[model samples]
Target: MGSVLGDLLPLAVGVAISPIPIIGAILMLLGKHARTTSIGFAIGWLGGIVIATTIFVLVGGAFGDSDSTVGAWIKLVLGVLLLAEGIREWRARGGEHSTPKWMAAIDEMKPLTALGLGFALAAINPKNLMMCIAAGVTIGAAALSAGSNIVLVIVFALLAATTVVIPVVAYQIAAQRLRDPLDRLKVWLEANNKTVMATLILVIGIVLIGKGISGLA
Candidate 1:
């Protein structure tokens, strides 16, 4: 169990990034429709974790345990970057940009389309992938971690889904109960999205950095 936990902990932490209020806010603001937004969010979150883990595996596989140390350092770097991103979000002011064109088109997509969109996002997101891979290396248990296939997949999926699923529920509920307010809130979110994004980024970054550094030292 302890070994299982060691393998799972980092991925869980990475997944937890989604439910973060500021991060949630940013995700909400990113898409025109809830489905697309959620898909994008989930994809982004899942991808980051997967990439992180993959990177760790590659490095560790090629150079042996040295990759673990590098992974620790990488984690610290990611943490710092997130912190900076958060600060930018928290401080951002005025109208900056609209949802990217691709996202807007996605708003009209069906659920399966949304799901596919999300899957792709998760598959490709560099940060998400790198973060997960880095976390794996940090665990330092290639064989033990590798052996628990079912458990690891479940943990990864659930944890990653949490970031996407929670927000979708909240957004739907809010849209239903507070229609006008929801509209207003969405507008407000769009207007000040950067500040909120920066704030979340900063928080995530700081936490990652702290954890990474602690692990490294």
Candidate 2:
């Protein structure tokens, strides 16, 4: 269990530190309907992570056997994909960085729209989706008891959702104080999103590759 959790930590952190979702959360918190929209976004973000990771966990479990080779190969393939994505981000870092059109409209979004956007970012976005799948595969490949798997999934989801949840919850408690800070944060995130993601994804990719190689050996 400890080893499995160890393997999952980086993957969960990868999801948690995704700049786009954090930026979205911050934007929603600073919007007119801050409270409701941010809360709805948080729920959707959390649910998306949970659902995506859970589905992959079941898939991994279904393929589990008396061998570790299959799991290691999957990790290696995912690592390569992530690595390629990281390179792409790094190369594109110098390109024109503009506020996404969708983000420009965030201030006017309803709670439901915010919710859907949050879900799409967490579950459907390629980078985050890869990390969730990796985490799920780690948990499922461990062949732990059912109860243990559930606990691990919950832990991973909560950890991954922490960044998105914190600002929303904090804003609810201290709206006036948080607004400026959140706005500033959103700006910074937008500016540095590519560089940050590139560095983070590259490291995670290397780590996954190492783990996969070690497991296979």
lDDT by residue for model 1 (142-185), tens? 33345454355446656756645555656655655534554565
TM-score of each: 0.58, 0.97
Q: What lDDT score is found at residue 98 in candidate 1?
A: 51
* Consecutive 10-residue window with the lowest summed lDDT within model 1: 18-27
lDDT of 2: 0.90
Candidate that scores best on TM-score: 2
| lDDT, candidate 2, 111-148, per-residue tens | 99889988999899999999999999888888889999
* Overall local distance difference test of candidate 1: 0.53
